[model samples]
Target: MSQRPRLHAPTKRLDIQGLRAVAVVLVVAEHVFAQPIGGFVGVDVFFVISGFLITSLLLAEHSRTGRISLTAFYWRRVRRLMPAAVVVIAATLAAVLLLVPQRAPQSLADAGWSLVFLANWRFADQQTDYFAADGPVSPFQHFWSLSVEEQFYLVVPVLLVTTLAIGRRSSPRVVALSTLSVGVVASAVLAPIQSTADPETAYFSTPVRAWELGVGSLLAFGTAIWGRLPAWFGTSLSWTGLVGILVSAVCITGQGAFPFPAAAAPVISAAMVLVGGVRGPTSGAAVLRAGPLVSIGNVSYSLYLWHFPLFIVIGAVDPSAVWWTVPLSIALAYVSYHLIERPCSVAPLAMWHRRERARFREALRPQRRSVQVSAIGLAAVTAVVLSLVATDRVRPIDIPTVPLAADATAAPTVGGEDRPALAALGKGIVDALSATSWPELDDGPGANLVGTQHPECGRLSPAPSAETCTFGSPTAERSLMLVGDSTAVHWIDAYLRLQDDGLLAGWRIVTRTAFGCPFIDASLGGQDATECASFRADTLDRITEVEPDVLVITNTFADTGVDGDGTAPGAAEWAAATQRYVVDVRESVGKVVLVSPPPAGQSVQNCYSVGGSPSACITETSSAWRSRLAALNAVAGDDATVVDSRPLFCTADTCPAFVERTIVKKDFVHLTSAYARKSAPALGELLRSRSVFEDTLVGH
Candidate 1:
């Protein structure tokens, strides 16, 4: 619609503009629509383009003047980037304050960090939690890429200057390429390892991503050396490059290792497109220089800036209206380019050395000073708003004590109103923070509950055979084995304390837990499915070898391949798996206890940190768990003793997250150590009733 930006002179390399359009579109599509395309690689494409264009400009400047002007370069970067960034960030913070007060504190902090270009480090330190997916997307989260590029812009100039200064005998290109090559190789080497060890940290860290930008800088050297190539070669290279990029988008998903070899496809392919742009006016060049693509490319920067916040805001208002995100983003990008970007970036150049008289003499003069005052006012208002949000606090709900029933192991009744006492406790916690509470939670949603105290032993996925942790006496007359995943870890401390106190004098306990790997006969869904099957087999063998008098089976509903509904297609298969495990275990162990998992609640830790009352995170029932338990019952038959955990964790209609002033679950589903210890009496009593520990004398 609007004319292509004249500042960069489009005809010089119109294809780069087309690439920009493609990159921004990919990013927007992925974020807004959750497309299967690995559109995240779009940022890597931007990194390469930035490396090439900026290096090309710096080299050109050095060739002309024999040195780079650091002041001019930085000023231009700030001039081009900062104005629009400030506007978008301020607006995003303001929107958060108005719409999602619960996220206000976090959004304010993110904005503050983003302003200084430290968002990537901040997110890395936070570990960028996956559980927070249920919450509103942070509007400023996309600034991590901007922070990376800004960091690159800061370091590269100094690196080139130092390298050239030290290697006076060598050509500038040689020194530049050598410096960039070293960074590329070192970072490339580290990406895969770091990605495997800590993917969240690896994804956000500067060093891991530096190689991507370095690869682009190296491409500049190649371009300089080769100059223009044949037209036919350029066309073929462009087509192949496009195909490679498309393949990467189609093939790559966000599971497993990323940003190392997987990212190489898009990055190298983008490089190909850049290289092919050398000899212009070919068929491929014609496609890139087309009017529509050129227009989008011209405003690609604004598109990138506006899209994320717009998508977040749309979701905040009405999650179902995701369709509005793309069209509105394009419209806003166009408006932002014309109204803010063009005037701020270009007018300063026009007015750089003008006399005050010239402006006074003009008939239709630009109100540059008014615009400055308005911008400053907006910034000041944003600061004040964020300050209020950051400092806001809500009073925590007063806890009401309820005595733990000595017979808490009583069987829960089916489909009835919550017993009065449990209902009261749930109401108190839910009312802790009012619906209109300020500044949200400090910690984050339910991360604590997902973690275990003995993380070293219990948190492994497909844990090694030697990963077992033993409690109680090795020479005890009776043995008990607790096996499954993290869900079983919650009950461990309780059992260990019982053994420590000598309640069961002749009993030994062994626990084998692998997070996400319930001892099922069936394979799991993700990349580690086969490995989990192997773990299930290994754990079964361990159970048989120990030949424990009693075996406890516990796992979350997620193990059944049913996320919400228990009656999903895979329920029968899960039941069969449970039955298979049960049949195998019955042969070795005298008794088996199939522990029904606790009801899944909202992140209580997150709720507490967010100033939520107990009720906010507390729920009445874990329907999903109920469905899974039913599935387990259908196939488990009479071989195993079903230890229904409802009475221990819930009170008929309501499941309370807190009991006797202690937080029951650290996160959504895992029990805290203190809560586990408190539950030992009930669990110990239940086991005795089932004859699991009837032979042993129980004394304090």
Candidate 2:
């Protein structure tokens, strides 16, 4: 049998400090600029470096002592990682309490999960409908990465120790390397597939992250392989790898188009740099060894810990001051490193090293004690988190649930299938446009948009195209035409209530799904996009053909411009375009009623996913939304009667999803049919106050 070569400890530390600097910078850039498709690959780089360094130390200990002490390993990890983590978590909790009022319950629940390192599952469950325009932001969003690393730490040691138990006779290096290889192959193959299947969940899940760590482990075990590479080859690989890292950071944008196949570029590139640049006195290695870079690398952990909270706090306090806030955040991060982080890290390491020189075994026992204490501290944290969660569940927000009306409009009977009554009214409008048939509309359930389709005229044949899908109603004597985007369709339920009550005596409802078009002379993709052109032409034709009394137009006035909060579009451009749309609509129709949208709310699905209950998702009143609505209302003024529903939907303390047993909205903003009916009284009062009903009744 061949004898195993004695394990050789690395005389030089891999540029871990340099690697950390790269990781921290990439993460900071991702949050601040949100560019570079591979910006997220920085986490993968961290994972690989962690696995490599940790494995090397563990293997070295096992080789020297013939056994590994799980307690000592965990103690060192806890001392190195937990103190900063605990401080950050505690500080964040305090900030949330003081700075964030009317917090989303779902966010609170996510924070609870994060405290316990279960953020991966919490985020996974909530990411199902990840494409929803409105979703609550978890305050502890960064903790998911920590959870992945912690989970790896917990599992990898067990696997390593088990392998040792089975192979005291075989080479521990071979066994460790073999296991790492298997993990790397499995993770790389599974990660890409998962990214395609469910990108949001895959992004946060730990299993998918294992491959990054496995890559580092493999490198650590194959140090001899790297050592044997030619100097020229290593230098070329190192420079190329650094270039790839920079390219990934500069090119990748965080708008759901990243952290997938594109992420492979940065992950592979970072690995190559780590492997190739860790040897010799090459230029790449020399750069990493620079004084400033090495110092930043040493304090990288502190910088990472402080930067996020500083940004979040600054943004919360002065959202419009991004220019100053960005620089201020960096300043605060540097101060935190110098004041808190450097002192703490140096003190602990000094104490640990001093004790290691004398009474080594006795000193190691204290390390085990520290590990036990950390374990107890973790348990206490878990209990506190569970208690908060329990308390939250037991004493949820006191949202009043209103009962549904006994005389609520009945569902429409369609081919023996019961459908929302409002759907029938919309069908009537479609039928009238198709056949050009007029029928007497009664003030019955079918007259309501919720009840039946085209009560005046029987069912018409289906139209072949968008141009042909039209309907006319005898009640449409004044020719009221509804037009715009999906927001227009949302208002149909409310319009049906007016129609059922004999308010829209002469009107025709028309709709087109123009994905993101405002009803004006707008260009999309550097040209007059189909939706914009169609909207302008169609409105002109409809006005000429129908000669409408009142034109009701509504579109989400927030999505037609640049985004401010890194999630949704800003309101400045949207407000301007909406004002223009109102002007054009007013010119075509004698009267126009511009409805300001409801208070922006959290996604119902996201809340349920995270909090496990509908009541747990509360709508947030965004200042941006309020500002845009105000701007729109200011522009419309009396020329367009602005119908604001803020009072009807929200109270001073809370916004109840269901008002009087009727679901006010289907998602974040659109009203449900039952809820729309409830709005009839308030809407009628608004119309009367604005002389809208008077104009219709007097026929002037």
Candidate 3:
């Protein structure tokens, strides 16, 4: 009798099917429930299972026939996976064009990638780009995992065949075992390193993920040795593994180190379950073989293909109806399981597998080299043509954003009578939610005109030579400094415009800004905390030495501990740190203007398209922010000019993406430089009105 259990026999093996069911449920719950389940490791479980099962099948075939048939393997894959996949892709594209025409382009691009089984690469590239990956999401995002699997399938067979050829005298099992061991080690080491450097890219990269599969393959190769363990041992291992998977799914989080340490919980647990099932049915096996789980597993492939699109479309159409998508997805999957999966893959595949020996000689037939060369040449030509025609990357004509009038050389100062009408800003919330299209803004410096401007004075890390970042009248003895984080940098354009309008003819302007470091006395916990700390130290010393006429503080209040003490935000923390900083700086400066961060709600980046209205992205102001602003004012203690900026970006109940003709924000939090420039008149008026700068000053 064969030492290894029959991996392919349905009657004998329902536990594997049950495991698949558990994996799919975990993945679906994470997506549909909006809770922290850490269920993404379910994909890792699938990878391990694939590695083990495919290895078992391949090695078994080689043992029985002395050779593997590439033709049969690839054809069987096509029959099993492609039919359902193609139908879903086509249907999703059609649905996007029909029901949600605004999203059709995203759907179409996703379809092309999915069709070629290269969705992972497409997503990886897009996800790495800050602009492309920010807000717009694809319905076919889940297809990336399928793409990784298909790529694995294409390469693994070739790897096995090549390794077998290299060690002709060695047993096929030995060659597979040795080759997979090295791959597991190499991939395990690379995954965490790459994940730390660029987590999104590492998430999709095949090389980084190969280790998960290698673990399963190693288990499969050793099945002969392990399959003979006692029933009691198998039972104990089975329960332990099931509990491990459940606990990991409940407790592990995706925000930390990831796939390496946390993923081991599920991967090792899955292997244990698989091994424990090799003998008589263990208690773990009995639980996994439950009817509902086995049934879900039977249709799991189709269910996965259907659920994501249904969830996305439903959420878009009516968020209230989104909960129903899962049930509908299962219904559709059941139908698809009956019609497409069984007819195309299951029923005919049994007959094909039975007759594979008869077609061995035909499978070995080689194709002509000329055909291969011609095909490759055509593909290269097509790629070149596509790249050139992708001029959509260039700025589109008729951009939704209004540019400055040609005659307007500088920001026109506006006050009481000249303030533009706020009631008639970007599209209304009602119109916005149902918008079909909007302008696609160019995503270069145009989008980041303010935040990315004046990097010498304002950046992510400490700049030793920032002493040289003085912008206006460098030789003037009287100085002004912009202080705080990237938010403080937002006002650089307004100040520059002030100098242009000859408001500060002789006073020099200096900047002490870093991306995340605010002029507050507290610790921050983010990737750039160290750099921010260094910059904070450098700027603190610089500010006291320069002792400028005005010290402007600007930073987002979203970070909690920034309340002054390194304590949680509450009744005590609200303005403690901020007020303390402002009070201390007052001793060495003329006046301090504490500019509050402008009101920003949800991102409007993906809320509309080229034909859509900006109004569709309208959102409500946060009461918490209003409370924070009030706390800052309460703590000002007569030393600072506390400017509430909500009037510039918000109405009583609504906030807008655009004000007048200028886009108010580039991303969710920061403003466009154009809006800052437009607001120059108001900002200068506010500073002058507050008497922060002496009425008769240098350059006045």
Best candidate per lDDT, number?
Answer: 1
Candidate 3 per-residue lDDT, tens place, 1-700, comes to 1122111244455788888898888888877885436777778888888888887888788778877888888887898899999999988887677545766766798889988889889889875421122244678988888888888888778877777767778675677678878888999999888776776777788888788888888887777666788878887887788788888888776644456655888999998988888775543468789999988988889999998887776454433345766766776776676556755663333343535433432332332243354345545643543353233223222222232455222112223443332223223322322333343433321223355456566666537375567777657767778888767777787787777774565778888877657777766643455677777777778877878877888887664333333334642364787777776666677778888776655444434334333444566556667677777777786778877665556544356565544566766677677777776666665666557776323232
Best by TM-score: 3
Q: For candidate 1, lDDT tens digit of each residue in 1-700? A: 2222243333578888888888888888888777735887788889888988988888778778888888989887887888888999988887766655666788899999899889989888988842134233468888898899889889998888787777767676677778778888999999998876777888887889888888778877676444467777877887788777777777776554667767889999988888888665443546777789888998899889988987776454433344666766676676667567765564344353445324422412344544455455545644653353334322233332342344333335322142443344344333432333433332233333334556655755536444347766677767778888778877788778778664555578888877767776665654346667677777888887888877888877653432222122355666677778888767787678788777776545333333323344445564456666777777666787777776566654356556655566766677777767766656666565556655322221
Worst 10 residues of 2 by lDDT: 454-463
Model 2 CA lDDT for position 376: 58
lDDT pick, better of 2 and 3: 3
Cα shift from native, residue 549, model 2 (Å): 11
Residue 60 local lDDT, model 3: 82
Model 1 lowest lDDT segment of ten = 559-568
Q: Write the per-residue lDDT of candidate 2 for residues 1-700, one digit (tens) a residue.
A: 2222112223254355676777777777666555443465676677767887888888788879988899988877665666676676677667655544334354567667877777777878877332235433455676777788888888888888987777657776667667767877887787878776677878777778787777776777766678788777776777787778788777654443334566677778777877776556453455655666665676667566666664554333322222343454444445445444433332333344544333434433434544455445545644654464445433445432232244122111221123233233323322322221112322211112232122211111121233333344645455556665544555556666666674553455544324344454344331224435555565567655554566666666554422322233345556565567666555556677666656656433333322222334445456666676666666776667766555456533245444433445555665556656666545555555556645642133
TM per model?
0.67, 0.57, 0.72
Model 2: lDDT to the true structure: 0.56
**Cα error of candidate 3 at position 443, Å:** 12
